[model samples]
Target: MPQIQSELSFNGLSVLYQIAHLLASGKDLELIMSNILEILETSAGMKRGMITILSPNNEELAVDVARGISETDKRKGKYRPGEGITGKVVATGRPVAIPILDAEPTFLDRTGARKGLKHSDLAFLCVPIKSGNVVIGALSTDRVAVQDAVTLEGELRFLEAVSDLIAQVVQTRRRDYDRIHALEKENLELRRSLENKGKPDLMIGNSSSMREVYRQIGQVAPSITTVTIRGETGTGKELVARAIHQKSPCASGPFIAVNCAALPESLLESELFGHEKGSFTGATAKRIGRFEAADNGTLFLDEIGEMSLSAQSRLLRAIQEKEFQRVGGSDSIHVNVRLICATNRDLETDVREGRFREDLYYRINVFTIALPPLRERGADVMLLADYFVKKYSRLHDKNIERISTPAIDMLSAYHWPGNVRELENVIERAVIVSTGNVIEGHDLPPTLQMKDASEQGERNDSFENLVAAYERELIVDALKDTQGNQTEAAKILGTTKRIIQYKITKYNIDFLRFRRGDSTGDDE
Candidate 1:
């Protein structure tokens, strides 16, 4: 029988302490679970940590949170009672430890984490997580195999203690989980309803973040409350405002838009509220402002953060009183207009800095809808890109079919600093410049071609090396497209055949694999 190491016992205490702190932190459940797994790995010498929760029907255990596992594998990591090590532990409400995973016939590696590993050196431990004797889940982990059964037993005990802490957290937060599940179901229903009824144009994503945004929009659209749409520039704040307006009761009336930053301070006031014929030198005639023009409808004030302090004061008055006096006019003109404001600027920061009027900030910020940036929208990029491609194809009268795989990769890898609007522009440009039916990698902007060195794990690489890497990629893509035909690839690249041959040799690209119909360029 082997003994538990003194150092491990000390570390185990620290691990338990940290896990308790994390569980009590009241942070997001997924985040807390991830942090706990990270702590176990770094402190307890555990690897491939996973937390599996019982299904609502108690029919199976599903991987709820995991570390050191692929998302695909995590999805595959499911087990029924008496199925595997994890399953047996949860089924019997007992702890299990296999000193050598390879020796256990019941060690089913559902996650595939141990598929090709030398399992002789691996040990598996699983403990049932219970809420007052009723098993709710299982906490499982892998560590280096120990020679002593007693050491494994000690480790199992330690894991059981950890599982106990986890159970407490699960039991306490059951209400939170239930509430989150309810909200998720509600959001799904709302999304389906929108899909059936036709979603608003420019609101293109179905990501969880975007679903929350849609839910908020739906919650506020029926009312005439002031809405402040906050997001980075090019994130389609105006589109959200329009969606709100279209869904509002005042949909039939005029929907007027104004860019507060586009107009000068001298003209901005006159722009929002009408001016008399002799109001100023530039006021040649009595022109109605956006507020009056948008009467009984929605008025979208874009870049509201850029409005001057004077304009904000007048804006606040109009919002509060539902009336305002135009420039050089004393009569109080009232109109039933619903106001929607959008801004990329940090209004809170501006308020603190005295750059914006605090009273106006509170007035328009009655209901705030935050738009997620394009980079955070995940696979929505592909959806948007496809939409833009078809839109531009029709407008430009091009017969563009689809974007190539390499082009798609470039688009996905690039961090869209300018958000959806930038993606729209990129797709339109790609469609315009694309001569063939398919948009290829070369059709993308030069910025997308050369990736950041740090992102490619070549941070120390020189500028020339980065360019060379992009050049090699282009050459390889061209070769693959032409079926390793050097002459044809040269024609596509607008280069001589000799230069193409030289580049192929210089870059060590396997042109023959392409000829053999193997798109996987292993030689390179």
Candidate 2:
């Protein structure tokens, strides 16, 4: 029986101990593998050491780490199961030793590490790396061919032991990696929930109804569905359309907005579908239509209810076919655009009256988003007012900071008939006329003091009743702002949580109503 020299056996033992220590010390897998290969080359007289791991499907082997190998060679060093000598070891769960590589007909140097060597000087060894009873990968190296077969066999055994150590480390890391991946997925879901709890950027609202709107935006933004936004005029329909476009997959592409109500039937048709040079009277140049311009992006058509029957027919065909021809041009032009339509009119009523096509309405209304008017939105009135105040103040370069209490009262008491647009206009005009940093009640239009004439004599209309109603609205707004967190709401209002709790109980306010989903953000 032949034996490894005492000095070589001691060196091998030392290398194995150090590798085991590195794995135990929690070094990174890539660094440990690289260090292991270096040890084999320097201490064990093995050169060009390589490690390959089996893909999860076990169809091919991929080089995980290697010494004296270029990135180009490493990328090309893939082998199907049982295709090469290294692949055979991993497939059969056995070791392979080629004492004279040139003499072996099956030896294939895929990595090209041994270009000019023959059987007399170069030898190769490959062993399976097994985790328990399953082969997971392989480790291979080249060395000087020894004359005695027993000496080479002993060396192969030592390599097999090293391969086992590598397998153990890989198995442990893979388990840890799977656990971390699951945790990250859970964290992503939590973050999405929190995003829904409040107003996202580019939108303003604290009401639960508007939170639902935000949720809708989140759901629809990632898709290319045709969205029909319905709301009262001036209720920020265009902004909702823009939000959808900015979040969709076509966000990087162009965003084109067309106000269907602003143009005549003839001009609208030409504008939307494009006209060729001299197609009609005054056609000077070939114009690309909205559809072509908005290709690979989003197209927003506002006031869809205002489009004429003649134009609507052409629009329907363009959307359904995803292709159209320029006016006076015969060539078919194809376009890929996400369509968003908005209407303040009751489209269903129009369809019933035979003024709008039912088929066309259904085509664009694949996903409908109904925006609440400012009056029904409750506390969102003051929120929008404050936002407008800050926006115009910055634009007009004013030092305005707060809205006076009396002004807030007038804002809350009177109903806004024209919705958010009316509120924004009122604030812009007030900001211009006000002499002080605070917008006083007198700075507002007199029309606000006399509520709407239509709503006159509808209730008791007492001063005390008005004040109590205003207080309730303020508290409800604060609760919404804090997502029903009573402590945070009190802090925002500069009051104590106990007072907030008392008022909540007395007013029969359900704070949970302000919460959008399964959130424990509110204090019990």
Candidate 3:
């Protein structure tokens, strides 16, 4: 059997392909729609192609895109639902075609675009743009008439297909707008909550040490004073910098940060202060530096102790005089930036050893804030762990609820050499490994399981300690052998099920972890 060809002409197919390419390019939706109208007018034998979008309140249709129509006429074209041929299609969710526009008295020339053309010389085709069975808008185009019903029907079918494509783009843009609107509302709410409570909700802690840090941030955030943050690596110095910037008078300005240790001495000067074109061998174009980019905002210099002595002299001049010349240029540019610096190395020791500039150190050390390590924060560990568990569970799309008691004990007992950053990594990894709602001790890395020599030596033969340790070991072994079956585990241990249940509760063991392919088990 021979296949029948489509009524779409070769030029019409080419125009549709062009419209599809524009959609796939991910250009601005308004520009894409305008180009589609242009293609329909020039190549598809259609004139005055127009796409009208529903207003925000859904009260009327406004011309969003048009071709071969005057600006005045486009502005005049507004239709309510069921008002005319274009409005009727949107109201009824159907397509309409007029073979002879002159005979149709209902063809309201609201746009005045057909002022000189007679009704017998043109045909009108309109289709509803639907999103999931709901008509959101309409697409209409007119063509010069040969006064035949079959030709008008074919053009109507082609226009209907184009309307479907337009509907998809409209729905995608609507969903994206809704998502962004929701996120902006959430951010505003959080900012309002912080202002109402007068607290630094971004940093999570309530310990005495953290309280002092908060006090420092509150004292200096609203001013333009320079700050120097002293702490070990992974102590969240960047977070403190951001909190300061957010609360400062320049909250709406840019915040630029650079690591002094990341670049070599040769490139550090250009990286911080920028350079003029043709200044060096590879300097073919002019560049803007961090100091200039951060003007009217905050500039955070991380690892400041690693800056070279030559760079230190230039940086001191820029800070004290509030100006500096670009590399290989004599023009001094002025800047008004609030500077915040951080370093793990002791700057006082560096000054005494003649490695760092004493004058520069005094200039940047106007105010200092120190952050404590994770091991020193005490109960804050469990709080941070809980926060991280929730964060990673959402990111990984898992159902991890909370850390088990035994796992919390293990986390609190270990000395965090890498500080809070290390703890975050450990929790993130455990969230990935956990199979149920609760994170167990077995889900932790092996390094956390190994007891240090001091801890091992401290476990003396106390009456309660020895009994608890032995009982925990026996229960774990039995549960492992029986594949997490409580009845079989009790029989193997030669004890009643009641005793086994009591022991499991006392030790906080997650027996379901041993079961095969059980990701949704009840936590006991």
Candidate 4:
């Protein structure tokens, strides 16, 4: 008897050491738990081992991992709190040891794993897995009945230790899952907000003029009609063309863009139509052209009014005949393509001056969508500014919270001659150079401050007031950056802490508002 007891003690210790190693393996939680149960069955004489975890809502327990049970049986093994042996253990936060499974009326073999076995010859044991004072789940197993009470108690105690290890892993995994879910939710919300602000297409504006542009895009996108986008430079003419192409039936095909003004007249023809090898001095290999590349798709010709009259003749033939010969290649390489053209110059004036083909202009002018300049979109300036601020803040790794009121006035008052593209560049530069959380008026370019005489007369502010306002804005921004720490603010401003205090008093600034949580500060 002494020899047998010594072997069991040594085996129990070995089993516990293996369980500890398995818990620290950093593997998938289900796979690790399954491996742990397999070890218990083979080494510790346990059988039909299973682990059950509480659901997220904590209303029911379901089998999460099991050994010696079919997957179907494992899935069927579920219980409410206090419903069965497993449920009772988790509900009461205690261990249960049934000496004979047949004698326990509460023993419900939910999995039916022991169906063929004589119930009188089986023993069942279960222990609660707890995280702090809350029971999160239960671990259970059964074995051939043990006659000695001490041996049954020993088996139950070993299972309890294994459950404790599982509790730690479960808690850690749940925390990681929760964090990932929260991040996914936050991302979904941001995408929805962007979509709402730019409804018909992702162009970003809610003004009446932008809404009209969106309506025109929607009206003409489903058809095969040629589209001409008319707008000033930097007014998002290419963006409008793209929106039409994306909504068109040819969205799945390639979208090729070319700038007629950027290419010389000598190369413009060869660019639109493929060049045969050995056709020209530097035409080394057979090169595919933009029209062929955009087969079954959209070809965006920007600044189309700049194309030479010779190139315009070939383009008009292609539009009329739906086919054209490559430069220096007589083979009429036919292609099916949708054409979208953009131009800032008036084609009517060019036609009269013989700079543009009247026939080609009429063909591309089947559908026209005019983009609104940024200066004309009343409230859209602020919307676009905020959008650019958020975009550049993330790109440059800045924490810019908001634009200051004075900066807003400056942005609203300035005429955006360069349009939306210029505004985007301005915001990106401001984000890169800002030293605090707020974008102040001084952070903007000097051009915005240079107002015309008529504009200056309307405001009629003195130079002294302007200087004071600028100074107050700088001091407030510094305080916000330092979290109301006047010493840090003063150091950032290249002044003494006492000067910062005096300035704060002079400006009637609530420095405490910048501090998070506790609204108190001390400067050393």
Candidate 5:
């Protein structure tokens, strides 16, 4: 068959290729959109352009991108859906091309597509980027013409192709978003399943202090002793509570925890004992209390020292009698929950200060566990650091293989005023931010280091700059040897065109200098 007359203009093909390459290159979306408009105009010879899409709420179609249009003109017709040509295509789910404007119909150009007002002798073409029979968005481009039918037909074809490309892009984006949302929801459920006593991986330490804690947990976790853990914040007190329950025969039961300091007294009480329907304003339904939720399991009260004295008194009675009434309910309910309390404050001192209950302290102090903070854990920091680095790197999908030697030294030397919990948080942050395969000193937070963060940032910047400069020099030397021809240079360096281009951009290598075109701005 003989070749047919081509409608795909050379300029339009170039623009399409550019857009496709940009989408393929995986560049950030904002940059891709910024240049897309100019490229489109160069190809299809459009005077104005607008890209509109259905919002996430699906309540309205809003303009996400527009070019050749002004803000004032947009106000007149810029922010509505199915308004003019753009809206017609979206609503009808079909392309609309205005060849001669019919009888010069009034253009309610809500898009202000090009400039701020309606154009003279304006011709328009709009196409819907439909996905799965539903129009996700519309692409409209206008031109200055006197309603020439043949010219409009060719332009419409150009836009139809653009619309097809756009539809694929939109469908692909929606799929990626749906997949990500599903993964996030799944991870949230998994996190809820894995978490216990507010401590992740709640394992008991083998140290002497923790051994005693374990012994107490073994003794009281099975039996119903209102076990209260005493230690500073971030000391693995909650972990000890979890350990007791795991070791106890009630290992099959739920392990529920509530931070007393985090919630208000009313909410905390309701959380613990639950509330009857109509208990208070916004109590739409009867809610199960934590004790009822953790029935036959262990109930952990973290920051118990901060709980209200009245709450503590009620809590003490529940501990002694193994029963309690819900808030605003007259009926008393019996529960078989084992109580485990943790506190960073001294309850006895609180008792003396007349803030905490003496009776409640005595009841919960039946089994006491005090966790030594991380600074006193001997080589445990190194042990936990290694364990956490590996665990969290996999969790965050990071490339970190291990902590560097200097990082280890810093970890070990740090006083850890906040204890094991703080160490975990710092390591997690480093794992998130660090780009290298290993955790370096600069990766750690400035508060964790001897040097200020700004100083550390500057030092890292300087070092990176030095390295980049050295690499640029190496590339330039290779190119000179190859007589400024990239293919030969790449062969000489045993690389590819892509790699050379990357280095050239990274080092800002000047080919013109090597080409003998000019020595101007050689320093840059």
Candidate 6:
């Protein structure tokens, strides 16, 4: 309610700074307007301040926020076009300045906002917040001394500058709606591509852990060093490699990707190093390898940990010397290509265990980035879940507007062993099956329902009941792992089949109960 003095408040540059500071807080728009009024009152030396927003119909204006309007009178009073001086100011689409409140014949006093204040002693200044070339809303202030109206010079000019800024805010927010809609559309197209024998390379997460990923990318992208990305399978290691390629110096060039694990040793050797005609039985013609194809660009080697030992030796030579001969030819085909390798396996551990070559590991590990599994990103799970739902809904031509809050809670609680890749698949599946505007917890995959019962926050439960529920789930899970092949299950579980059978029967271990893919286990 504190107002600023006029001479010090309504100046050029200072107002813009204040407006930016106000917007940065991200408060409610109404609260923002109230603060604006209070600042005008204190700094502009106004007795009272009010701001009216134009309704969509444009026939009436709503008193969105005010500094001087009492709660009781505010509920009883409202503003309409051509009713009072404020309305006339809006209707004329120009600022109004009444020197003497009582001398103005057209003035109508309906604001019973203040009790003891003489109506005639008040002077009014009102200007509209414009829409396009026309006025959409009005900003009006009350001054006690009529003579001070002229002294409060340049107030209208200051307000008009702010009006322009508010217009920009509205325009920018309208663009956000369009952007959000467009993002949904792109997501839909990507989902369709994914459903029809295609892959979308989804990256999901906004946690601090994910921030580390972005940071590492920024750090290494400017350099020309070989990078090795490590994480569990389905954790988006390839996506990380792609991000590195995108942010790197060779971004404009080709980004050739090769899966080291998917190809056979012979085929992989030919793939990495170009082959001549008749290099092998299938080599009917010459072929360019990934290295030559990615010349002056970047080559992304996926599942690098699975590369054959012989291929590893050849790869090390090519990486270290930047030269390699074709599979059947002796000519040294030199190419300048940045190397980026991704794998779910721990290359350091593999090297120590003698499964991976230490020299190759060191060469590729010039820079390393490790991505965390999805469950570790906290609220980022919900962020990504909503993104996917909106995306797939549009792609599949569905109408899922949102995911319910409970569904978000379920997402946060569940452990995504397959990481981001698995979470995205689950969301796509739910979007395909969901039948409402919002996705609910029941719509989620069965693995999410395997509640950590020992946690006190299973909706509600005493500590003792929580523990009991946990024990119940564990016993049921152990039986499920056996898959009703009880004798073998029992031996693997280190218990007699009879005792396992007793627990199974006690916990209702019928495979039919777990029939909807109900078994919840972590693969990573």
Q: How high is each candidate's TM-score?
A: 0.50, 0.52, 0.52, 0.50, 0.48, 0.49
Off by over 4 Å in 2: 1-200, 459-524
Every candidate's CA RMSD: 29.3, 17.9, 22.4, 26.2, 28.0, 23.5
lDDT of 5 by residue, 1-524 (tens): 11222664456666667877766776655455546666777766775677677644343566656776566654454334556666667778877877654434544555434444445566777788877688888777767655456756666777777766667666665566566765675456336756633443446355444544555566676676677787888887766776677777776667777899999987988988998888999887677798887777788899988889788878887887888998889999899988888898877788998998887777777766666677655577877887778878988998788899889878876778888889889999999999989999889988766954445566547668656645665677676655466666777888987798788877777654455244232222
Model 2 score (lDDT): 0.83
Report lDDT (CA) for all predictions.
Answer: 0.84, 0.83, 0.83, 0.83, 0.71, 0.72
Better of 2 and 4 by TM-score: 2
Model 2 sits at a Cα RMSD from the real structure of: 17.9
lDDT of 3 by residue, 175-256 (tens): 7656676567546644763553234445888765677689789999999999999899988887898789889998776667
Q: For model 4, where is the 10-residue window of minimal lDDT?
A: 1-10
Write model 1 residue lDDT over 1-524, tens digit each, in one string: 12334545447777788989998898987888889889988888888999998866577788988998889999999999889888999899988888888889988888898778999999888988898879999988999887755677777778888888888776555556676775675466446535543456556887655876887889999999999999999998877887898899997666678999999999999999989878899776677799997888899999999998888999999999999999999899999999999999999999999999988988888888889799877788999999889888998999999999999989987889999989999999999999999999999999889977657765576567657867876777687667778888888999998898899889887788456434433232
Note the residue pairs that clash in candidate 2.
Answer: none
Candidate 4 lDDT over residue span 269-373, tens digit each:
999998988899999767779898788888999999999999999999998888998888989978899999999998999999888888888899988887878
Judging by lDDT, tell me the better candidate of 1 and 6: 1
lDDT value, candidate 1, whole model: 0.84
The Cα error of candidate 1 at residue 262, in Å, is 0.4
TM-score, structure 5 vs. true: 0.48
